[model samples]
Target: MEKISSTKNSKVKEWVKLKTNNGRKKFKKFLLEGRHPVETALEQATEYEFLIVQEDFDLGELAEQVDNDKLILVTKEVANHISDTVHDQGIFLIGYINEEDWQFPDDLSGKWLVLDNVQDPGNIGTMVRTADAAGFTGVVFGDGTADFYNPKILRAMQGSQYHLQLKRLNLEKWIRNCKDQGSVIFGSILDENARDYRKIDVPDQFSLIMGNEGNGMSERLIEMTDMNLYIPIKGSAESLNVAVAAGVLMFGLAG
Candidate 1:
């Protein structure tokens, strides 16, 4: 295995650059930290560039899975420099980002969770994990939504990202495509005029839109949805968190 002991190594510097969005865009790759995510990525057969580990860290069976040429042994200092977390896991993987053009499917089916201008990485990741748990086909990141590859989101999602399709798309065009395909589009809002989610029948093929954390759904999006839904708050809370609201609505509608 190629051993990198210096934090100032040319390769180490390039890997550190992946911490930013622009660097990831330029390099066309992102870093995966810790064990579970790296393990999941390997298990899913994700295309990867390298499997880097601290010299003393035990790889056990994992070592056998990685090609000899793709494995790199790094010193603890190098590992710390590459880590995004405070307490480093000492294991990491460099994964190639998918750059394929994603288009709306000709036939829309199954449940899809759409985010409109949702910027919080944690919230977006949580909703995606919840959607995966609810058996939704995928989650769409609309304009203004945080990048899926954001390190924080990648951690929050754990391994659920491998279980479902994820896409970045223009919600307006996507919604219109769903409408043309006869799939019901549901918008979540805080408006009293919207129907209570519990009272609505769940459709097998539908798209659910959860909007910005503070500003609810965009008015134009709300106008485009087949129906708008709101969850009744029996407590003193002003409103439910977007992720929590999405979970309730996704599972409720899934049934």
Candidate 2:
């Protein structure tokens, strides 16, 4: 393992760049934060790049659980220099992220959730974490969505991204391809034309389409859905947070 102590190092600059969409694309890596998520990656360490921890943070039980050779120890100043969050856990990991090489299951026939342009890393991560819990086939992220490799997204995903097939796709080509696969597309909406999400028989072979928090589903996606569905709200909050709505929908549709 390598130890880096300088905050001004070039590799540290590159890791900071990985925080952004363009940098992740250029470098082919993403940052992972917190002990839980780092443990998740280390669970599959053979596939991961390396752990980046600060001089000050605890390695947790991971020191006994994982190989020490896989870790990249750096100074606390180096961690603060590269982290997006102010409250640093003093530990971050650089996982190999490939935006262009998602390998889907050959028999991917089941419930799925499609993200249109979910900008919030928290929302993206929560949905993914729950999606993993509920056993959806996978998640397909369309253009304009937050960087899937963002540290926050990875952290929020809680390592569930490692378990499921995650695809970054061009909306048109993806939808067209999925049509042949046995995926019936369901779009979440509020319009009267939409049916209560619980009423429909969520196709065992389909993807539920969700869009931006404020805009709802895209017009094009709505037109393509086998059905439009909405959760019946008992409370009056205008609408559910995208992440919350997704968890409710995923359970209802797939559970």
Candidate 3:
């Protein structure tokens, strides 16, 4: 319900700061950008802390649907300072920082996903969305993975983050833990040892690991997996994008 006209205002400065990891950490929130992403966040996120809007942008019906106490009206120029995209989508949301650590269970009894250094935010986000739709229990981000809160990732996910059990993990340690639990870990790779994706006897509850964009899963992580699986491309393309690979595995095998 607070209206901020001054782009240089202290509060506006704080919102601008949310663009960075340190700032996001300190404030415990991130700016949810783009119309669809913001709308998805509004529906799934528990708290509606702030809705920043440009004065001329009509939120007409949307304004009525939101919690009135949490809205903030700002000038278009004022809002552009905090927006990651050049053309503002007329609205963005400030969502609560998720500080919760979804610990890896000792049993590894549930379906899960392990992303190892998949640096592309779009790929990572799409993987998360795929995992959610496929009924996977959670997605674990290994060291060197993209920041899940990165604007591109958030936008691509369309706000799927809130419902998923997410964790940034020490992959080697996490893999070792799962190994003892009868959980089969599949690494996406192109090695001679790699089996056609469908030929692998994927356990009912296991983890699928997607690795870096250029390099597939790390050597050590591949060793940690029960086996390696690859999509047999009839074409000559050397590799698939990590996210696209994940989507194929998720929907093809798991769906």
Candidate 4:
């Protein structure tokens, strides 16, 4: 174990850079704060590179749960400097995120959720978590979606990202590929041509496309889908949040 007391230490500075998106990309690594995500990372067997702890923080529970040789102790100020959250947990994990070269799975027999240009981190994260809870196969992030490793998203996902397949692909290409593979594609768009989602006979395996927060599905994707499905708004509200709509569709289709 090494002691890193100063925020200006070389190692501390390097780790601190991970607080930024570009920094994480540059280093091919990210920081996991608080006890839950770190524990979840260990449990899921994610690449655990190293651990940073506050000098006076209690590590008894974490130590018993996760045994790691690369523990670095730092002062409270250093921990605060590295943590983005207001309530700093004092425990951080330096983990590597190996972006997988995910080809369209050869077996596309399970349900999947596709997100297109969904910019809100909270919405993206919640949708992924919802997909996991609904027992969907995976969630694909299309162009303009929020970063999967964003701290806000990481917190919103509540560690469910580790449980399911997450991939980044040109959604247009992905849709065409899935369509060629005999998979049914459904786009959520509220239009005259669209059918009520409840009326359609849900297929055993399918891909549901949830569009951007402000706009529904992209016109290009809407044209490409097998059918455009819409949920009727009976209330005074104009529309549901993208994540809420996704949950309704996911669980309904899964059932």
Local distance difference test, per candidate?
Answer: 0.90, 0.78, 0.80, 0.85
Residues 138-175 of candidate 3: C-alpha lDDT, one tens digit per residue? 88988788667778888887666776788877888777
Candidate 2, superposed: residue stretches over 4 Å from native: 56-61, 64-70, 99-105
TM-score of 2: 0.89
lDDT at residue 54 of model 2 (Cα atoms): 77
Error of 4 at 255 (Å): 1.3
**Comparing candidate 2 with candidate 4, which one achieves the higher TM-score?**
4
TM-score of each candidate structure, all chains considered together: 0.95, 0.89, 0.90, 0.93
lDDT of 2 by residue, 1-255 (tens): 779999778888888888888998888887777777777777776366667887666776777965578677898788888888888787777777764445444664777678998788899988888889988878888887886787778777877888887888766666666787867777888765679986776556888788998888778877876778888777776888898888888888775
Candidate 2: C-alpha lDDT? 0.78
The C-alpha stretches of model 4 lying farther than 4 A from their native spots are: 65-68, 101-103
Regions of model 1 farther than 4 Å from truth = none
lDDT of 1 at 31: 92
* Tens-digit per-residue lDDT, 5-38, candidate 4: 8889987888878877788889988888888887
For TM-score, candidate 1 versus 3, the one ahead is 1
